[model samples]
Target chain A: MYIPTYEDMLAAHERIKPHIRRTEVRTSAYLNELSGAQLFFKCENFQEPGAFKVRGASNAVFGLDDAQAAKGVATHSSGNHASCLSYAAMRRGIPCNVVMPRTAPQAKKDTVRRYGGVITECDPSTSSREATFAEVQAATGGDFVHPYNDPRVIAGQGTCSKEFMEQTDGLDMVVAPIGGGGMISGTCLTLATLAPECQVIAAEPEQADDAYRSFKAGHIIADDAPKTIADGLLVPLKDLTWHFVSGHVTEIYTASEAEIIDAMKIIWKHLRVVMEPSSAVPMACVLKNPEAFRGKRVGIVITGGNVDLDRLPWLAAS
Target chain B: MYIPTYEDMLAAHERIKPHIRRTEVRTSAYLNELSGAQLFFKCENFQEPGAFKVRGASNAVFGLDDAQAAKGVATHSSGNHASCLSYAAMRRGIPCNVVMPRTAPQAKKDTVRRYGGVITECDPSTSSREATFAEVQAATGGDFVHPYNDPRVIAGQGTCSKEFMEQTDGLDMVVAPIGGGGMISGTCLTLATLAPECQVIAAEPEQADDAYRSFKAGHIIADDAPKTIADGLLVPLKDLTWHFVSGHVTEIYTASEAEIIDAMKIIWKHLRVVMEPSSAVPMACVLKNPEAFRGKRVGIVITGGNVDLDRLPWLAAS
Candidate 1:
């Protein structure tokens, strides 16, 4: 339950420097002209494991003591985090145990295995996942690195913003999708100390607006089985994430499923980068509420690029 | 036809620097592991016009003297060149006239018009295109900038290699898709003068293997009509480009349509960058002839990113 400090983020950055990519920031003249804002896309999608989670995953893996590294790391995630953590552990020559829903896409499971991660499958329920993960961690004596809630993970994610600001002269606001708030919280953790003048904005799917509600209600509001095309953003805010979202996020903007899909297509069309629907949530929100962002320099975090090309959402029969 | 020299490329680089992006070189560890080569992808796709042609277009447009600039520029191509030239003309506040096939995709025509290019439609035949271009040029008094054959265009395209070399420590060889030979000739123009030890390899679709055959034959062998899924690489090499290809190119490789599509998908899946099928020819050739590139540092140009999301080739029903 530790609040990762600015110092922690700086240390995590140095520790994870060689393990993760300091991905390039891309700009589209067409998007800038369309949105009436100078936009810089931090393409964390270009990370070796195709996600910004690698930043945090590598930080946590590399920061572990030699004795603890020997014990290895474990996490339960069905998305980019699982593969990213496995990739980081492989780089460190340590064991990584991933607890994934048994019915999770085979492609995702294959990615985890490709990175040398051992999988413990669970029934597709939170209770089953927790129980399975607990058993695996107990059996392996592995460090349980909560995907976003762990202080080390948040600090690693915080370094993304530091690189973003360095990439651009400075951004008026930094926007990212909020699922468990790992990325947004990390952005807040860095900007609050590094560039206090910059606004931290969180974007979410309209269907899963728990973060927006929580921000308004002044408390954590967990959603049960919420669904959206932005599958990466279905999770609710945890305590560590809630702390930063409540304290530093200047706004939480939500976009409909249709809008998120449209943004994803537009980005692919113009930015020419394949990324997750969740990553487009920020662009979708900005486009919907243009007046707020016009004339401002906006940095959008394209969090991950893990996509099933065979069934691109845009190509699916509507 | 004038043969552009190394100094011409240097001047073109300076001329077009203000108008075009020094597009980044991206790498994929996954791709490197798959191909058994250290591959550097010079992402010309990230240019404002979404292709490498912008370099040539900007050079041609900006290199024009005030008197010639007032007359503006004209070209006849139904691909990226038309739109890129129009974009450059618009940047320079000059009129651009394009003679495109009337049957060209409405989307492409729309792109040219959006960039303020005036389109003069022609029948979809070489004779009709040349005649229509002549009439348009006569009526508008605009200078003709051949899509790839012009010395100015070749010189401008050569700047790509200058930047590519500067971006990487160095490369054993450079490979690019060769249709009209603008890009490959440019690479030869730069690398021959700058890094003679570096090889210049040309890649082409087997269906459009004129360049490969011509290189072997030691003379220009223009195809009457070559067709492939890589629409951008349909044109045959012109005499101006032939001079550089015959003089400096080390080897020319060809890939089947299936291989090209497979390479495009693999790159999209691993690099997470949306690029044209023609751009993937180099990777396709490399993968097919892995022994040639194994353990070597190779640079491949991802030439463009202009793709229709609704009609992605991979997603099309087989």
Candidate 2:
């Protein structure tokens, strides 16, 4: 198993600092009152690509040598990673190819295209995605950058926690929504070295709690398909991500679908930041486990702001 | 004639700096591409009270002497001003009384109460509001703070444009939505002294085109009851606001209700910020009049983020 060191994150920061925005850290007085915790929100939703995936994606794209970069970079994702990778590649003036499931939202597909990505559609299954991506790689001769399992990508995401430490003082606990364990693994990688005293917690949806089940079982347990409002957190943990999750993360908490939606609306109504359902899972954990967070200074990492405006979750029911 | 000097705005900035957030100026790549104008959005929607009115409201609340502050402050507004004034008073630990139209949305009324404002509902009419306000003042003995007509409030709004000048370089034009003209007057007050070369423009909804008509007629034209999606821009300009509007404003532009809603969706989709309909009129103007704004850098004041989430205009139509 390849373990990413703190120095890798430091180097990643130097490599991607100019390309990615050091998104603002904000506080919600109402949220603070509700949880009885001084909550500082790391707003990665404001990132140029509208997500924290840009950090990892940029690090991977820019770290490649000229000859390798000329061949271009490719990723297989149906979420923010596809657009973010494309955005990073565009910034570096490199070609980017994305293999997305045909079932992906048109908005997500449009975002990838807007960032100058060439998209190839595939069946929404793992075998089909792998086969389609392999064929595309053969045709384009592109470097394959895995969404979360790569050490370079993990190191790149570690840069976020570094900024969090610099932005706020003395965070007793840090929480992030676990979606294939990319963000949580990066948090584990950083907090382990810098502030081991600060507990690292992973939040997951109850309807799609593969990470929680894997954590409790003390091994990797892959779920074929789980349905949740948090579409981003449906993917199961990988080997490298599981390594960090098992060793460094202190706990994994889960929230119901109703709780997640309520938290999402609360952030919009009060904080007024346009974040997605995945971003609200961590907040849902904070609300559900109030005793664990009360009187503690907590940092919640807002993962992304990509949502379909027309089919908003609250409006669907109303 | 009570002309607000630039020095008063400087003073207001000093007094309210601790209380108000120095909102960030964000550039939208998509908005730039859509309008052919490099748009710099001053995001006052990020304010704690979800609006720019907090700046003026805080200035008024904090400017009061201890004896005057002891009696508290009062306003007759049905929108952001009511909640913002209450927020400012809450911060200063003083009483805030708001006489609002009973027809106002419950969400708006709830926001006022959340900030500890004592609400006295009246019939939806100028005469009824004024009459009810007088009775409330007699009962509570609160100092009446005019929403936009007061010199101190306009000076407070001026600080936003002052910050705008410092934040960006070489803006050829600055635009803001005009209602009672608090924000427009403030923009005029600051830019007239600081960047007189930069054209100051006001945008209004065609349905509620009192400001546009007032500009053409060279005097204040009060509208009895005009309906539009941009509800915050319904109020007509007062004498104090008219002074700055007639003298310093370069032009007044209007947009149809459809254009305003479209512009609002674009901001929410591309900018990923939760701003209200009133804030979208300026962007709509830039879109409709592309010839005037094309290739020029324009600063747009995003007035507020207070919206009734359940009753979204587009969702209503759907």
Please tell me which predicted candidate would have the highest lDDT against the true structure.
1
lDDT of each: 0.94, 0.92
- Candidate 1, residues B1-318, lDDT tens digits: the string is 568889899999989999999999999888999999999999999998899999999989999999999999999999999999999999999999999999999999999999999999999988999999889999999999999999999999999999999999789999999999999989999999899999999999999888888899888887767889999999988888999999999999999989998999999999999999999999999999999999999999999999887877777763
lDDT of 2 by residue, A59-140 (tens): 9999999998998999999999999999999999999999999999898999999999999999988899999999999998
lDDT of 2: 0.92
Native-referenced DockQ of model 1: 0.88
> Which pairs of residues collide in model 1?
none
Q: For candidate 2, lDDT tens digit of each residue in B1-318?
A: 577899999999999999989998888676888889889999999899999999999999999999989999999998999999999999999999999999988888999999999999999887999999999999888988888999889999999999998999758999999999999999999998899999999999999999999899987788768999998998888889999999999999999999998898888877888889999999999999999999998999999998877777767778
Write down the TM-score of every candidate.
Answer: 0.99, 0.98
Badly placed stretches (over 4 Å) of model 1 are none
Give the clashing pairs for model 2: none
**Docking model 2 quality class:** medium
